[model samples]
Target chain A: MARASGEAVLTRAVRILAVFEPDRAEAGVAEIARLTGLHIATTSRLVAQLVELGLLSRLPSGRVGVGMRLWELGQRASPTLSLREAAMPFLEDLHAAIGHHVQLGVLDGTEVIFLERLSAPGSVVNFTRIAGRLPLHASSSGLVLLAHGSHDLQERVLASPLERLTPATVTDPRELRSLLARVRRDGVVITEGHIHPEATGAATPVRDRHGTVVAALGAVLPNDGRAGGVVAALRAAAHGIARAHTARTSDSH
Target chain B: MARASGEAVLTRAVRILAVFEPDRAEAGVAEIARLTGLHIATTSRLVAQLVELGLLSRLPSGRVGVGMRLWELGQRASPTLSLREAAMPFLEDLHAAIGHHVQLGVLDGTEVIFLERLSAPGSVVNFTRIAGRLPLHASSSGLVLLAHGSHDLQERVLASPLERLTPATVTDPRELRSLLARVRRDGVVITEGHIHPEATGAATPVRDRHGTVVAALGAVLPNDGRAGGVVAALRAAAHGIARAHTARTSDSH
Candidate 1:
């Protein structure tokens, strides 16, 4: 058989890897072929190649799952490493003090992608998980990121239909634009029941040495009137994260 | 030009990704070509394709670094996810109580690969990082894992030359065998200055529902006379992690 183009093969490999989600981490060649819409033979060949490279592993049950080597390589030089490292101590502190869920998020395209999350047993309900994504208008982290984002990003998000995750989610473009302005002016956002009725998300922008927003430090708390104290705590943690990131970046260089 | 074999191309892609390290995250095409020993044209083409696949990203400085998508995908369905998640809360509590470096590690091949580490400012000197590795004989986590590892794995590792990382590192095969026996009997191991003179590592095994040692919960602390407290703390945390993992696994299944 003729070899596929290198680019096409790599793209297909990515598709194969992407099919393994948290809930469905293992798949047989047939399942992979069905998921990726490739022929069974092609899927078998690709899965074998991936297994050879340690990007996928065969389970004892003969199914394949994401390999540890892939996780190692992805983590060894992850772009979010420095930020996550810097933010972790502070996130832990905030999580301990607030006894809820604390997280760090960054803007990826028009959505907010969480880099880290710390949760306690019986903490407030949190919809966001590590490596999870949320719409720009529906999450407080996304709101903080969008508020400090570039003009192009702001326009792109504004032009797109805002997904309303809950009744409190701001779906109107004009209201969102003004809310973003307030986030910029006030430097913090508190969304009550924006993503879930039982939870509240409060976030503030974390800046770098150049004063550019690099991430959002947020907390998910019970939808109680206790958000007043959380905003101050979130701001403090965000400030600490920014300073820590700057120091870490300087040390690395 | 003829396209490379799919297997060769994937191997080359793995090599390219492996070249980026925590300290040296970004590299230009020339440097990547030099590092991977690939033709400059081939390196450039593969890099461009990786960028398109979002496995690598081009920085504003024109150098490339591991992309956000790579981190996201690696974390989404990592084999370590369930273990890490189950251990995180316990690790945090231990970190808070000990005010030192708390980590979770699993035996990967002949080495111990840390899946998570929590460190405090001005904490004890620790040589490990998230996704970092240490030899089986020179780390407390490694010793704990090796103690309960498969007989074949144990024999192979023992037969291999054990590099002495420090004066305290047990390099004598007979002595190491006895030490492993002690670890198995005691359910914990402590290494004083095995990897760093200023620090000590103490670890205990975390078991799954089947009572298999799945991970090691450890702490890096000052090499003072305080290992007693740390050992108790490590055991407690390991027990908590194992129970949490059992619960989580059952829930997921």
Candidate 2:
């Protein structure tokens, strides 16, 4: 019974945390209770415990926000952080060369979650943010991931109703399937106005030592005649990142 | 009874999470159970629950590591993320100009925890990593924060035994107190061989709208005559980050 209750409490905690989105970083006990559908007293007790553990912090406004300890814990050992650290040098090089937005993304569920994004001032307007999600059928990074993902994942995405973000997003399953095939064959992808009319995304796969595609390295640039250069840069950076990641992981073992 | 058990579970969960440090990113259940001092059965049960919630993931090596979902949740709403986002562009600029290491750090307890670090290839050796911590009297960023910290915090740090990372590290409370006074007056701090012999750290305080110091922007470069240029660039970038942070927080409200 104690074990069951503990699991239930963890589920509740996760639910409460899920509500604190990028835009809404803090909330009161009552607001959290409402959002998580837990009793006010229970929410208060759990929140107090979380604050004591340094997983949540009390804000000046008498609300609570995610704590620095939580971020530290997540960053210290998250596999994503390892991948991100390995790719960051190459990402910076690509960012300097391309002079726009460079990102590293991985497939999460059916969406692509960006792990890191390096942007320059007055660069192309990009909708993607660090830790932001984009649809698999509607982003260059997403397309590359979807094309290389497992068959079950691909079928599940193709069977669902694809949300069209702009005129250029591949909404039709048939067209998206062909696009995936081409991306797999070419090992790179460029999507003009897929997410935004003013931006173009080009991505390539980053692989592990076993030749498994692990992440997507992409650049978002202006929708101009500059994609040819971007693709070559991305491919080279991806290879560099893959080599570095392999070296890093192997060194640890 | 349920509430008390739930809180205990959360504490245990945090203890388990805390064991995954930079050098040890993944661990077997038996190792975790031993490290956390929980029964093997309890640890296995809790780890299973954590995996179900996506807070931990199972690796092909049959070990558990910090999950990508945990990193996403931490990055999405942590207050540190806002400060990091605000300072990133300026940090990048400083990195490019300095051609070494640039970082943003905030006080966590008596230590300073780096929120972000931009490093270049073949740059000067830096001991600090993103999410890494350094003693308040042994790092330039830490000294700047310590100099501007509250009286209670200052007293606590002074009362404790100051760790000596290098021969030049400030160990005498009287000397450290004087150094703190100088940092507060000059609004910047430079430490030579405090943590490492071949590296120098220069930092300036980053403030919010109310003029309260919230972070320290610093650069780790070679302990050479180039310290003058780095100090000027760090001061400029710190001001830029402060202004950007104030603007971003105000715009949100």
Candidate 3:
């Protein structure tokens, strides 16, 4: 195969894998090929290779799904696991103290994939699920990630479609630009625009040893406009997580 | 390359990936070659290809580590994420109700690899880490998994070396046989071996729709003989997790 053809095959493989989301975990090869816009033969061959490599497994019913080996490899390779593990205690503290929905997310591509979430009983019905993705311009974690993200990433996101998630969402690129600027300047985001009208979120960046913002720690509270204390708690939690990360790094050495 | 050579290369790649752990995250090509008994030239070529494929990444300091792409793909391709997501709420409930270390583990080979754990403030210090492995004949989760595992797996584990972690660990194959029988009959395991002397763990199996034990949920309590309630909580949590798993599978259809 040509270099471009090999790259195309790899991209198709990724696309096939991407089709297996929280809603769709198992699919036939024809379904994958149709979803990925690839030839059925190519999809079948690639899926077979993946199964042979233990990246995918075939069920007893002959449907293909993501395999346990893939999960083991992913769990072992994920940097988010370390960060989430370190933040769990503090997140639990904040969740208990504030009695809201606490979340930890990391930037993956242009989206925020939630790593962990703790919800209080009778909290607002939040749609954010663990391992679920949200746009980088909608949620509070997305705002922190966008604010701390690279200039190129910011420009790319600004140029792309900014779908309106709610009536309060800032979909205009110019307004979003200004909002991201304010987030960078203020070091926090309090937004009611992401998914629910009755919920507001406060997010702050969790920095690594090199001072790079690696993740966002945030909490979702009811939109009663009493978010100042929540913001302070989130910032403190982020700081605690960062300190724990540093300590763990040093301790492991 | 010949077919056998291709298989060797693939196996070598897996070995290279296996060498990287939370403790040893980065290594040089020479170290990988030395560890896996592969030629330096072959190791270099394979590592370079893996880097190109985004399965491994080269650091600025001239060492290589598992890549973010691998992490992303792994996260995207694992059933473990779905399992963890379904189990987290009940795990949290158990942690709060028991105020001890709550763990979820799955049988991997003859060992049990912890998938998730929730610890309360001032919980007993245990060796269970995410992705960490423990022997099948030792810990409570291990005993549950081994007891419910396939006969082939049970025999293999029985034949393998059961390294004694503590003086209380059951290393005798004959005693282990009877203990596994008891665990199978009782549907739970309470073990004081393979970890701290001051901690005792009670574990129960979480079964899927096919009635196969897919995972184990356990709680580690301080060995002050106040473990009856904790064991009940663990069993209840395991049942809750199994119900959640069934609901998720049904909802996916």
DockQ of each: 0.83, 0.71, 0.40
Candidates ranked by TM-score: 1, 2, 3
Alpha-carbon TM-score of each model against the true structure = 0.98, 0.95, 0.87
Clashing pairs in 2: none
| Model 3 residue A153 CA deviation in Å | 3.2
B162-228: candidate 2 lDDT, tens digit per residue: 9898899999999999999999999888898899999999999999899999999988889885687
lDDT of 3 by residue, B1-253 (tens): 4323333445566677777777677899999999888889878877887777767788898889887666666665466776787798888778878788999999877889988888765798787878788888889999999999999998998888888888888999999999999998988888864567988988999998788999999888887777766767777888888888888778776
Q: Which ranges in model 2 have alpha carbons more than 4 Å from their true place?
A: A1-4, A224-226, B1-4
The lDDT of model 1 is 0.92
After TM-score superposition, what is the CA distance of residue A3 in candidate 1 from its true location, in Å? 3.1
Please, what is the whole-model Cα lDDT of each candidate in the order they appear? 0.92, 0.90, 0.81
lDDT value, residue A179 of candidate 1: 98
